[model samples]
Target: MAAQVLALLRALSGPEAPLEELRALHSALQAVPLGELRERADDLRLGPLFALLGPGSRREQTTLCVSILERLLQAVEPVDVARNFRVDLQKGLAHPSDSVKTLTLSQVGRIVESSDAVTEILNNAELLKQIVYCIGGENLSVAKAAIKSLSRVSLTQTGLEALFESDLLDDLKNVMKTNDIVRYRVYELIVEISSTSPESLNYCTTSGLITELLRELTGEDVLVRATCIEMVTSLAQSHHGRQYLAQEGVIDQISNIIVGAESDPFSSFYLPGFVKFFGNLAVMDSPQQICERYPVFVEKVFEMTESQDPTMVGVAVDTIGILGSTVEGKQVLHKAGTHFEHLLMKVGYQVKNASTELKIRCLDAISSLLYLSPEQETDDLLRMTESWFSSLSRDSLELLRGISNQPFPELRCAALKVFTAMANQPWAQKLMFNSPGFVEYVMDRSVERDKTSKDAKYELVKALANSKTIAEIFGNPNYLRLRAYLSEGPYYVKPVSVTAVEGAE
Candidate 1:
């Protein structure tokens, strides 16, 4: 059996093996038990299989070879594959086909996930170099896969040392110096590895790579800073990353940059990221603390809401939504008092007059502002959300109902989302009952035509039916009507009854 498998693989070693032959080999290998294959691994001569994965191979051959290689790897010891197969795997990475490189990197990702395989992988310096080099390649998909594999390798202490404590660290630096795009890719990889744990983050910090990335955040190049801000935001997603930034005073530095951005001609380019970073910070940490600590961040968010630039307004609106999602965030925004009211007015105007995209964003922000989880349903927060809803206009419910009737499905769904968020509030439910057709609209199955719109309307009815306050607000009869709607799922169409009218052709 070993000799037979070896001869079949040797047949495929050439530039373009016969497609039918490759398929036959793949099927034959599938039937062989992994234990039997492992016993005969030496005679299997897998190098030829890896060769079929390289450039100049037909697509069908490449696909079949990948399948065969996967099965074969499970048979061969992972450590041996990591050690002896290094050169062939590097050839796959160097292959001209992005598909080949991606498929190869995926296998590498699998190998590194096993503890026994990582040391041998880390031992091969050239393989490591090839992976890092791929990060700067032309294909974004290939670059991302390379990034993922390298990040996985750095998950352990030994792997971190190999990447950061060795000459490969210098190689990474040189790659970054090649271009801003390559530099950001490296930055993204570092952020991914560092976010894993305090130990991994410590290695990244000690290497000075994290500091170098922060330096770019304050660099003279607005484009680089803009790109770097996103990476920094990614890093900030992890608690350890956020702690490192705070300890290094990076948050203060970002706020100062926002303050000075008004004078820069390129302010618009980077300011949104700067704002979003703070928005993320506010949610991750304490919203009130962040807003108070950096009043400039909040001020900038509100200012951008009024900007003529759609991008700026969109980010600002999103930030507002984030800040208002939590109880603390709501209090912080409510502390602004009249300023908060003005922002709501702008959002209402946008809902009525802005582009469909912006209008949906405005509705989302309103939904975020009005939402009250059952646990957080304190009297003060409830009143606060009610007041915010009222400030939208004299008749906020009527305005949203108008949006729900719009022909655009997205706007209709967004408008319904806002109602869903409002559904649990007793005050809002009272208003819904008082409004002439609003209750009927919520119950009307024919109102929403598409799946998404139907789902949105069902969610609204479900919220109303499930609310503890529903029976009290709308009498048991109306509440029972909502219950019936809830019993029928989103797509439950009522069966139509047809009776032939007495042969009246």
Candidate 2:
């Protein structure tokens, strides 16, 4: 079956083959045996079949050819098959036909994903250099595919080292500066490269690529801005990258974005990423120095807490949280009480309907604010809670009920976290326990014995820990058994049990 399928595929891929025959050939090849397919991959006719199929006008045929090449690569040894068709494949990289180049690049990506093939290719430095050169070629599509292939290959440290030593970075920068269409691709490549060998950024920085990327962040293209923001954020994550970003005036640009009050949606989306970037920077650098140098930026972030857009509020909340988590941030928020109160109010409002991600962020912000603010600000905190606590509690209870009935453990865990946080608040606790049958309802659901229900029980343990009221409510022998199961079941289960025990005490 495989021999016949390969023969048909080879014949259909020839120039003289009718399109109908090729379509039929593709249909027949789908059921071929793996071993037989491997044997056919070495057939001399396979090269022309792949080359012809690579550039076919029909998208289906082209996709099938690419799939065939990928399957063949998996089935056959790369060393045995690659040498025979290397020249033909390289030619497809520059083929005037788009279909051919696309399929060929797809094949290259697959080969790059294979560790042994990548190692073999890298050992042939000349061939590797040629491939790198193709990454910056004039054809945007081809260049993008080549860049993606390189990124996949560079997953290994040796391959990453090769990329750092090669001229790929220089070429990418040159394209970034000169080419608008490919700028996004260049930005992606920068991120991929940085992720693999963030230290390689030093080489780029020495060559002034960091400055170029910073400039690109201000580009009019939203995609370019977004990509540059992501890349900068990734770069700023590392100690060396943070130093480079700070030196490149990235913080100033980021500060301007937050304080500039730019109402552009694109800018708004990029702002949180930038804030996150700065958070990483703060983690790496001295937050005290950063705060002192950019006090106004911090102020503006606090001011943005009152923004109508939940997104802005979320970012501001997060930025403040990052700041407040540090001594410098705590000091700044302490001096900015009215600002913190307004921010907390916005966060409370956001918790009502914010996306899950933003809600998680708001939760983190609340935790941070609770930690940093003076005890005297309890009134402000309580006021913030009053505004949205009822709605959030209602929503959280519904989620808890839903998770209790669901089989997934993670959702139940998430519900428990929301409950525990609410259970921590005095007013929320009073409301929850006072609600009609709410206490017994939760306790009943908590005792269900499904594997997925462990999360519910674990959360019950936490809720019981948060308040003396809960400890008294569930202090029975049954609840105690649940607590022991949570503590001793597995290493992973013990933390929740400990929290419950501490809360109960």
Candidate 3:
């Protein structure tokens, strides 16, 4: 391939612009060793093709010259060649024929892919302005190709930094502002630039690109909104990013769209991304604020958790977990008839079969309930917790046991915490101490040498011992033998085996 580019560069460099008109250059270019020209990139020069690109050049001549130029872009080896081509490509981008402009921008897009070439592209200030302006060109082909080029350039660190340095972000913001069709592509471009490195992402953040993305989130285009959500998720990955979005009213924006999702054509399609953003925002921002801002937020998320799409279910669960973490969020969950129960049922079902991350997230959501401050644990929250305990199904018990026995210390602790928390209530105390295999499950982990696991187990056992139903294990003849096993102390341990589920935490 490199040899081919080198050969093409050689053949194209002859006595005259050998081919009289640009069209001839096209045919001759067909067999040009593009691969070899790229190999000898250091020797490449655009001087020979300047006549065709100059004023008074025929359209066909310019078109063919642009084609060859596009080919020259392939190697990206010679930094100087890329630098020199930019001026000509910028000029050709204004050609009357859309095809010529399209080819020129496409080649420029390809050229900026190289790290070294990206710096060269950014070095010339005027060249940067021209490329950005082309994004909104009258020719649709030209605008789309320009956007494609911008996005491609953003793929590397050098190019992304160039984007920031060259003020291309302002150009993108202008395109998005004018209601231009290319705005969607610009959305995609920002997502690309921010996706690569922290520096690029921070550049987007500080530059107010996130605000543009949030506005795009409510747009009528499903794809545009979805892509914007993707960017929001990226922002939500870091603490400052999430907080920034929340303060920027991004959470409010998402909630509004979701509320109308059922009635709106595009909003429903935006649900998955909306759910994802909700979960992320709730991580640091107040889920209470989300519910307060959008009264229907909880209902929307509850409905989504039951959707056939597993992704919807996962994000719904995530948001619900965050909601349940706060008092206000729990109240919303508690008031939603059967939704809270449905969550427990759905989560219990998924606990055994779901990926480890899902399992842990579900567990964290449920566990958060147990540790709430006393004031937050209202009567409704307590009753809901107790009710969840009273009606534990066979699958639920199996799920609990499965979690209790997990090799991952965090998961085991999360599972046991639920049981320990339930045992605190006198009414639910009997159920906790007497639940089949519950105590032994605790012992299995409690007896382990790992201090965290052992400590969690002792906590579970202590809760059981505090229950009035301690008599059930200590006094009842039925539990007499089981009690003797327990009295044998921590050293009298039972061996347990773990089956690893892929992608579990």
Candidate 4:
């Protein structure tokens, strides 16, 4: 069996190894006992597996190598695997094939996930160097994987020390020196590591990479600033990260950038990120406070809503949806009064006139704005969303109802989701009850054929049935019908009686 395994490895390493041979190798390796495989791990010469994953390898071959490698690596201690395959893995990282580098990074990622593997890779300066070098590779996938692996490594204290404090930090700096594209890739890795924990963030801060990245946020390079905006947004996802940004006045720096963005001709390049960063910041923290501190963010959002560019409109609409979803956020927009009113009208107009993709986004934004979870549904917020919904158009329900009847399934489902979001609201419920055939539409499962549409219809029915205000607004008969629809479930089909079927056959 060992000889057979060795033979198969040799065959697989061949330039033209047949697919059958690959399959056979996979099956034979699976049949090998774990203990035996471990004992023979060295003799197995797994180096060829990495070669088989090189460029032009068939999908099945690549997948087979990954599976086999995962099983083998899991059976043995990661330290031994690293010790034995260190040179091969390093070569794979430097291999001309992006396939080779990605596959190698995948293994390194696996190794780092285990506590025992960290030290060996950390101690191997050459191995660490190779991994860091991959971050600056031309291949985006390879660079992302390399960043992912290194980020996993930095999850530990020792890994953090090795990356930020040791000579390997110099390697990372060298990698960043390659170009702006490569430089941002390294910055991305630093942000990722920093996002993990306070201590990890401290390490990153001490290394001065975070400061450097923020400097570029206000830097002259439009492209680099655009890239940095995205990275900083990611950093802001964490509590500590957001606090760090605010305390460091990076939030103000980003706000200043957004204000200045309109004057920059290349503003189009980075404007979306700038808007999205504020959108994210608003929801993550206090919508009112962030908007107040950076009124330009809100001004830009509204300006974007009115832009002719679909991209700008989409981001603005999305930000509005996000801000409107929360109670505090809803109040902030509600206080804007007519500006908010005008924005809702704009979204409705988009739903009617925009492209299918934009229509879906409009519907999503509407859903987010109107939706209030059972816990969060206070009288004021409900009235606020209702007021916003009413302000959408004199016949807001009719607009979405017409959209619900569209041929496009995605558009139709998105419209139904908007209904689901507003189903519990007293005003929305009354409007539905008053609208002809609206209750029937909600009850008719037959209208929705596809699984997505079916699930969406079920959700709407469920929302209506569960609403505390629904029964009172809809009255008992219609309410009972909603409950019946809910009882039947999402995919229920009505049974047809066929007494004479056997005779007819």
Candidates in order have lDDT scores of: 0.87, 0.60, 0.64, 0.85
Residue runs of model 3 more than 4 Å from their true location after superposition: 1-211, 220-224, 233-253, 263-269, 280-286, 352-360, 373-381, 391-399, 402-414, 420-429, 444-505
Error of 3 at 381 (Å): 4.2
List, residue by residue over 441-498, the lDDT tens digit for candidate 2. Answer: 5545444555645554556555555344444544456356545545654224323443
Model 3 residue 338 lDDT score? 68
| lDDT for each residue of candidate 1 in 1-505, tens digit (9 for 90 to 100) | 5556666877774656678878878878866788888898876677667766756667787888877887777777767777778888889889988777876787688788878887777878888998888988889999899888889888878889889999888888887887778888989999999899989999888889889999989988998888999999999999988998999999989999999998998899899999999999999999989999999999999998898998999999999999999889999999999998998988887888889999999999999999998888888988999989988887888899999999989999999999999888888889998999877888899988999999999999999999998998888998999899889899988999998898698
lDDT (10s digit) by residue, model 4, range 133-168: 988888999999989889988888888988988899
Best by lDDT: 1
TM-score, predicted candidate 2 vs. hidden true structure: 0.66
| Candidate 1 local Cα displacement, residue 307, angstroms | 1.0
Query: Can you tell me which runs of candidate 2 are displaced by over 4 Å?
Result: 1-13, 18-29, 32-45, 54-60, 95-103, 113-116, 119-145, 152-174, 216-227, 247-273, 283-293, 318-339, 352-416, 420-436, 443-473, 477-505
Per-residue error for 500 in candidate 1, Å, reads 6.6
Return the clash pairs for model 2, or none. 323-329, 465-503
Better of 2 and 3 by TM-score: 2
Overlapping backbone residue pairs in candidate 1 total 0
RMSD list, candidates in order: 3.4, 9.4, 13.5, 3.6
Model 4 worst lDDT window (10 residues): 10-19
Error of 4 at 371 (Å): 1.3
For every model shown, what is its TM-score relative to the native structure?
0.90, 0.66, 0.47, 0.89
> Which one wins on TM-score?
1
In candidate 2 the C-alpha lDDT for residue 61 amounts to 56
